[model samples]
Target: MNDYENMSDEQLVQLSLEDQDCFYYLMKRYDIKILRYIKRLTTISQEEAEDIIQEVFIKVYRNLNGFNRKLKFSSWIYRIAHNEIINQYRKTKLRLAMIPSNIEDQANLIDSINDTIEINGAYENLEKDERVRKALAELPDKYREILVLRYLEDKSYDEISDILRKPPGTVATQINRAKTSFKKIAGRHQLNTGIVK
Candidate 1:
């Protein structure tokens, strides 16, 4: 009967430490987001992604006492999930792929990229464009994951820096480089319907 929805992540962490049931709120909050993050970073099935998420939540709970309140909770949790994803890839040698399953999500990613790169597009029509998706998959793992974190996941530079454990300048540079790489790939795929600059 607690209004867990009204509580911030830090508060939930504190409560969860004292009352384990409160941990469910934290898991409930990030479960889907972390699952999608795993799926976006690799060609993993829902079952596999869910398994990774379970592991992520378990790690988060175990490390709750060590959670740095200075950092945003979302960033901290994502850092754990990112590490787990890397571990999974190392274990399974999964094909690295960025899977933006939702049409709206894909369009939002395209729009965000367009805004960041100053592309001259009002309508990208990327929802039905397999080439765009293919272009995304062709990017290097670093670039693809950065794009997902920046655009799709809507993480800020500092948040990304924390999640990736890179310097803020490094995250900014990687994001810029990722944008350039994506543009080049999109060009090769003839996806410049309204791209500019």
Candidate 2:
């Protein structure tokens, strides 16, 4: 074990400044978690998600000196990842809108998956997963952001508020509302698919 938890964030910052390898250690610790979080937020292709991950890390490396020790390192990195994904989404949406609809098929899209195994002779969960992802993608960005941050990223309301620069009470209400909205959307999708009676 690297005992990274034992080292203070300030110490890590100092070490990262002096040694590039030390910075790589921080990236190794958080990259996968951040990538997974980003994957749920946007429907970008896997290759594009990989590129965004690299870009987020590069931005983190360049801005490491400005990081404050008061905030947890994970919070700081996730904020960066969130910003990068949103930026990429805007760019992609603009680009796609400019292209002819028929030619948009050239874009490499990654199919999102949602899978869970059950032991009670239940129907395969793949259908449920697909419905959820479709419903989630249809939500407004504000609702989707709160949902992913709360459910998928497993971030506390305070952490999410800090990351999003929102009030804690607002975050809580947004999450509550988002859950209802998501359930409605998922229900509608299930009905449309003949998966629910």
Candidate 3:
């Protein structure tokens, strides 16, 4: 497979520390996966997602010296990404608070509609995809992250647990809970559209 896959973590880390190209290679391996995770969490404009992705990578690169070999590299990068997204969300909240109440609501509503439309267009059938995306959007971050990593990203429970720093049993339980929540939201949406269960 990939060079990194064959190399020991210690070797990769050593290479990354010594060479900028090695760091770039590491970023190339993980960037899209991390970006997809961030996008699902933020549900914001693409520009905002790009900005956060840069911030996350920067943090990861700068902090490489401190990385522990005991942890999986993917987990470490995702942890950085998760923190960056939370920071961005807080910043967004403060900015929204500074705006007029009516304007803030309207802006959020428009953004929601745009997100819905974008997600809808990605699927072959608009209504079902919209329902699914809306359901996903409703999930709490903890549940949503696990669900997306498990189902959408096709990661095993062990991988998800590592990424989230949770036990495998906890990841399994959270995924089940998230699926139940998603089904409820989907069922309600389908009923509203006259789609029979």
Per-model CA lDDT versus the true structure: 0.82, 0.64, 0.63
**Segments in model 1 whose C-alpha atoms lie over 4 Å from true places:** 98-103, 118-128, 191-197
Least accurate 10 contiguous residues by lDDT in model 2: 104-113
Q: Rank the candidates by lDDT, best first.
A: 1, 2, 3
Report the C-alpha lDDT of model 3 over 96-156, residue by residue, as the tens digit: 1111123333244323333333322233454554455565556676775665565455678
Clashes of 3: 0
On TM-score, the leading prediction is 1
Q: What is the overall TM-score of model 3 with all chains considered together?
A: 0.67
- Kindly report the root-mean-square deviation of model 2 from the true structure over all alpha carbons: 7.6
Best by lDDT: 1
Clashing pairs in 3: none
TM-score of 2: 0.70
Residue-wise lDDT of candidate 1 within 116-145, one digit each (tens)?
654333434643256667777678889878
Off by over 4 Å in 2: 1-10, 94-134, 186-197
Worst 10 residues of 3 by lDDT: 94-103
The C-alpha stretches of model 3 lying farther than 4 A from their native spots are: 1-10, 94-130, 190-197
Residue lDDT tens for model 2, 1-197: 26755676567778889988787667777878887766666555668779999999999999998887778788888889888877887776612111112112111110111211111223346655445556655667787667557655668988998788789999988876765665567567752322110
Better of 1 and 2 by lDDT: 1
